[model samples]
Target: MLLAVTRQHEVAANWDAASLLADGSVSPEAGCRELPGCWGLAQPGPGPGDRGPCYAVPAAVGPQLPDGCKAPRLVCQLHFTSWPDFGVPFTPIGMLKFLKKVRTLNPAHAGPIVVHCSAGVGRTGTFIVIDAMMDMVHAEQKVDVFDFVSRIRNQRPQMVQTDMQYTFIYQALLEYYLYGDTELDVSSLEKHLQALHGPTAHFDKIGLEEEFRKLTNVRIMKENMRTGNLPANMKKARVIQIIPYDFNRVILSMKRGQEYTDYINASFIDGYRQKDYFIATQGPLAHTVEDFWRMVWEWKCHTIVMLTEVQEREQDKCYQYWPTEGSVTHGEITIEIKSDTLSEAISIRDFLVTFNQPLARPEEQTRVVRQFHFHGWPEIGIPAEGKGMIDLIAAVQKQQQQTGNHPITVHCSAGAGRTGTFIALSNILERVKAEGLLDVFQAVKSLRLQRPHMVQTL
Candidate 1:
């Protein structure tokens, strides 16, 4: 006999051989009818002497399997539980355990285990996310937790029941990693609470703080600009120029003229061929800053700049010998380097104007151009002495417009972080202007895909 199990909301079978089972009440003809509140569904398989297909139903309606239903011997089973409560807590884990138990209890058992919860979305989605995260972690892959959550939500609506529940899952993940146990702890619980309050509270506090500060500072500066209250000294420092030079030429010059034998084995420039042209200014090294600047001048470039950490031991000593202002000319190319107090900033506005003679012009008429720049500041923050890097970028962009040169070259120690931010911001600005819309999240996502480690902290 064929046996079908379902809930009260489902259609009842009309055939004579099929009997409805509500709460496991057997028909007088030896068939069964099961209803809601039934603890479980356990039935025998059809023998050779069995008559026909059997049908069963639960008294409850919606979509959830009965509490203790083992692998039932039936063509199909329909669960009808409400949307609010569908899958049991730890349902995925329980389902796996159930499968194992069923096999152990009856070694000869062989059938597909079918299950559903509510709309077959939330519970199913949770199962998928946990399994996927586990697989990624097991394989030693780096998975962006935010990206993973976003992807799941796009695919399955109501996948994450609430923000608190989502935070709980993430906390559970940390526990699973550190202790190899899914059990919770006070620390993890606290983190979950913080996350529920704000998404970034638990994951990216530093990043969020930095972003907030940048926006606030920019807003203040813009307001000052609107009121014509910006310092006149700021105008004097406004004109900036960025000079792009070929990296291959710099490498060759470093090898041939500087007699910098280190280039042969230097890991930083490995895979860098003579054909590649993108290059940025180098920071002070064991050699004197003048030596580096001299090479920059020899390259027939008109602009030079450097990024320095506030705490570097070399900062004080290097600034001592570097010229307050100097210029070099070769044919039509004139290069300059100006002495500006080095601090935590990745760009210097006053130095760029004083050093690059081409940028000395009125604010309204002066064009700004940016060269290689980065986004890092000191670990503490941007020092009082350093010029803001974003200001430098704005200056260079203005110079580029005036000079009809392309955008500035940007680079960092590894061509990431500060470098990536500069490029990303520029790209975002251009796209926003072109489309008249701003999509900050999409812009960041596109950038991160191109350079995985582009936004590392200083």
Candidate 2:
């Protein structure tokens, strides 16, 4: 059996490793049931030229043999570390030699070979195709790689997952054809490959490509677009969208009046250390201005982060939701201007919201909320530079900490673009501050799970 070993995403390493340990038999010990039986049979066997850390499992523990057959089945597991997940080997000659070693170990092709990579479709398929094609070449003097790959895929989908991998099959066959078993220098081929597939000194481009592949899975993404459980009015009132099967949509309660509007285009988005610490929503639509204020009052939000300008390119992006002059009354809530300060690249407006109706607690009538409008932030792109955005996020966090613990309202034109970016940046930045390290890929993936299409662009 061919065992492919490579670095895996840390979060999925345990699960992926578990799948690799099982042989064809069921063991009596619960913990060792799934482990490769070879581990318990004998000491790790010596490999050919340090190419593999191979192991041999005795025939006694092999899957139950035929009732009357006394013959034994010997299993040799060859573990090669040359290949990596989602990546082609630097040179195919080394792997070609390894495959030849595998064939030499089991000359008669005794048992059904179990070859696998992380997903069991990428590197595994590449090794199988090359090995099978080389056999055909020795007997027939020619091979059709495409037909072989197509036939293999008919049985198992997504075999030889990338063009680079497919191309490697041809390269290996060509090398084997030109210089049979004789060793040939591969430095030139490695140079050409580096030119074709970028430098691999730091991050693995192949791994990133694999990640992008999983991110673009149409089936799972379409499943996230379902909205049957959402209220009809909420669906109609949405400025952005609700991910399907997601129940995190913010629901604002109305105690007095539902005549004006009952729904506001808003959703509760979580932060690094807190749940529902930030609310992502669209800029206040003219008709929903009062509803927006009611949300701020009901949720006891302390800050409103306005990412876009009030107007952009003659388009009224956001209505003057808060009081522009002395004071403004939106339905039952009266907002009085307390202070306005423009610092650096942001304009900060503080307001005291008081309720007209009598409340259960006398001290709960008035609530203070701050609106920080960041000027020069474009409608369709990220901030000019990261520093301004970072500073703004820091300021928001500082104010939230000083003020009573409350959710912050963050919004842009559509609420899913710039707003999501800001929230993701803040959450990741905070996580880095606390944890001393961060995984941008995992961070973004988690954010999208919470609010679909959040941080929409890479």
For each predicted model, how many residue pairs clash, with residues at least 3 apart or on different chains? Answer: 34, 2
* lDDT tens per residue, model 2, 257-375: 64324456677776665667888888877777887888898888989999987788888888888777789998888999899999999999999998777754768888878888888
TM-score leader: 2
**Superposed Cα deviation of residue 225, candidate 2 (Å):** 7.3
TM-score of each: 0.30, 0.52
**Which ten-residue region of model 1 has the weakest summed lDDT?**
264-273
Model 1, position 195, has a per-residue lDDT of 44
Q: List the residue pairs that clash in candidate 2.
A: 224-244, 226-244
For each candidate in the order shown, give its overall lDDT on alpha carbons: 0.36, 0.65
Top lDDT model: 2
Report the lDDT of model 1 for residue 268.
15
- Give the C-alpha miss distance for residue 404 in model 1, angstroms: 3.9
